[model samples]
Every structure is written in C-alpha cells, then in structure tokens.
Target: MTSSADAPRSGPVSAWAPLAIPAFRVLWFAQLGSNIGTWMQTVGAQWYLVDA
Candidate 1:
C-alpha cells in the first residue's frame, strides 16, 4: 500500500484561502471595520479627556 507521505499534492496552499468564501469575507470585513471604529472612538475619548 502507498504511504500518505508519498501522496501527490496539488500545490502550495494559500494562507488567505478561507477569505475566498463569500460569507466569511463579508464577516471578516465587517469585523475589521468594527475594530477600527472602536479604536478611533477610544482614541478620541482619550484626547477629549486630556484636553478637558
């Protein structure tokens, strides 16, 4: 019997292959935007507190 190590591979797999899925892509961008907004709000709050 052939060993698993001897099996042929299609090629190198991409790290971003999961982003190809439509639902996952949308969720990922949504999360990214949310995180950016949160960060900006935190920074703005800090600046306002410091300036007051």
Candidate 2:
C-alpha cells in the first residue's frame, strides 16, 4: 500500500504557505537580517584576502 508520503510534492513555482504565528514572522525577519550581515562580512573578508 502507498503511504501519503508517496504523493507528489509541490514544485518550486507553487506559492509558499503562509506563516501564521507572530513569533515566527519576527524570528524569520531577524534571521534574514542576520544572514545578510553575515554575507556582507564574508564578501568583505574575501576581498581583503585577495588584496593582501
């Protein structure tokens, strides 16, 4: 017998499910900001390494 997990998964073009929790929204934004800052630092470090 096939399990529910055997069903086809949605493709990337599918609309993303909404985040309903307020705490989740706040955490997601905070993590996004942190990730951007981390990426900026990484690029700066790589440039410095190449210049050295």
Who wins the lDDT comparison? 1
**TM-score of model 1 relative to the true fold?**
0.76
Q: What lDDT tens digits, residue by residue, belong to model 2 across residues 22-48?
A: 888788889999999999999999999
Candidate 2 TM-score to native: 0.61
After superposing candidate 1 on the true structure, give the runs of residues whose Cα lies further than 4 Å from its correct spot: 1-11
Model 2, residue 23: C-alpha shift (Å): 0.4
- Local distance difference test, candidate 1: 0.96
Alpha-carbon lDDT, every model: 0.96, 0.82
User: Relative to the unseen true structure, what is the C-alpha lDDT of residue 50 in candidate 1, on a scale of 0 to 100?
Assistant: 100
> Top TM-score: which candidate number?
1
Shift of residue 6 alpha carbon in model 2, Å? 29
Q: For model 2, what is the error of residue 14's alpha carbon versus the real structure, in angstroms, after optimal superposition?
A: 8.6
Model 1: colliding residue pairs: none
Q: Model 2, 33: alpha-carbon shift in Å?
A: 0.5
